[model samples]
Target: MSESKQDIMRFPPSKITDVAKALSGDLRVRILEALGDTQLSVTQLAEALGVAQPTVSINIQILEQAGLVVTAQGSNREKLCSVSCRSILLELPSRPGDGLHKTEEIRMPIGMYSLCSVQPPCGMANRDGLIIGSTDDPRAFYMPERTDAALLWFSGAGYVEYRFPNPMPPGVSIDELRLRAELCSEAPSFRMDYPSDITVFVNDLPIGTWTSPGDFGDRKGKLTPDRWTSGTEYGVLTEWSVRADGSYVNGARAAATTLERLSLKYNQPIRLRFEIREDADNRRGINLFGSAFGDHPQDIVLSFIRFKEHQEGKES
Candidate 1:
């Protein structure tokens, strides 16, 4: 990779087969995890794990070949290593009617995520604190395992905001917005209104509404819970939209953000908000699950993957 692209793009996948193979071993997983928080020498890792330097070297070689780790010249010409890519972004081959991998253009990362609570009854959550109960029950708990959390519940309605990184770099401006979440009413036993009507706001401007249908676990989720709740209910609903001016769920126009709806000054912060008000007789309240770049909600992953890929293509 060119030095400029490397500066812009943090991690690039080495090769699919090599990464798959290296991750197949337990020792290699440990080595990768050890390197996740800090860069360490082979000698340091060997001593930490009570393993031999040769063993550490062999596993690290596998990691580097797989694109999971990057070895480089450290301070004063010492060999240094650190994680290259933050996470793996999959590249799936196209099939009939498959539009997942295709994109007219890529978007850039703008800001990080932030949260704001409107009232006492409402709450906020993210990957860090998946289940943020009401302020009365401010203690956060883990949602159940992906399988067990068919639905997750919390009281009230407030905005979970995502703040994009500052200094929006040059790129094709973003025109589409997407959302993904796990959905089930209150319990695994109860079915939710498929494609429930919901409103999306960008920068406090009403963009549009979408009726997100139930996603029956055909794909792995980007933000799966680290642990499951001991005895609660949850489900999954991953949703996305393309209409720039208004909300769209299953092709019907509602409300959402438009290109004109946003103020895109360079280095300005961007905010995306998901607001869903439950109708009367709705049983489980709000159970939301999706991606949050840091601690807030927005179309972060899609934009981030595009930025990473764009930087990679520039390098190539």
Candidate 2:
């Protein structure tokens, strides 16, 4: 399946009623079928479906609210609508009357790190290729405007740390934690052979290191802003998960530091750090990509799954 199709929108039983309502209409179903093949404007969809433009517009609004389709204004100022997902899965409760299995997710902007220590050959840019300050200046990382950056790169060794709120309730315990980011090796221009060992740490405990294959700039990133050029174009979207058993990077075992070893506390926030160590076998440096500069339209994502008090005690 394509990446867009793989992106599933899951709804709980409570929201199933709304989804059912949205699908009950025959016109809406036809609209979705038409959009599945190609993006169309309101006028085009109306003509293709042999319906009036106003009627199509109304149905499109309903689909948009149901999260079935996404509509945006085109350069010509016409509304363009497209299907957002290829499939919808209704997620039932794990057990009858068990209530909802709550999960929390947080998206940290690429340049919103609270702490950073970088070396030369480092710089930051926004979506429009607007440089924040002098290149290789460590102080630029501290500027207030850094939060607006869509891309950041560094040579040699450095680390950026972000603090995320621990949303686990007082009695609840985290069952699993996952961190996701777009990353790649850093080079003066673009080098497919460049490699970098990028490490991730949670609460100062090293979870694992992922070896970036190369710095990719052969073509424009699918979502990279048009103004961005002469810089790194894209990167691999990497995900790392930590559980009680062990830690895994992209589904492969990378470290033995499990959730228990991290000793997470409910009152304290979680600290996450991404680094390229000087002594690493591959010191090609690192490039961090944000939604505006990468093929994937996402920033650093942190997800937490919590278990009930009883289950937590049993596992502990």
Q: Pick the candidate with the highest TM-score.
A: 2
Which ranges in model 2 have alpha carbons more than 4 Å from their true place? 1-101, 306-316
lDDT of 2 by residue, 1-316 (tens): 2468558788775456567779999999999999874789999999999999999999999889878888899999999998888889986644322232455689999899989888878999987778888788988998989999899998868899999987665555677899999999999888888989999999999899999999999889887878877668999999999999999999999999999998887788899999998789998788998888879999999998655423533344
lDDT of 1 by residue, 1-316 (tens): 3232233222222244456788899988887777765778777778777889888888888888766778877666645667665556544422221222223223322212255333333233445444344433333222123222222234344434555542334443444554444442222323334334445566677655544443223322344443533222234433445444555544566554545456655467656665555452322234454443211233224332122233312334
Worst 10 residues of 1 by lDDT: 93-102
Instruction: Please give the CA lDDT of all the candidate structures.
Output: 0.47, 0.85
Which regions of candidate 1 fall more than 4 Å away from where they truly are?
A: 1-113, 118-135, 138-153, 170-172, 183-197, 211-232, 242-256, 277-284, 290-316
Overall local distance difference test of candidate 2: 0.85
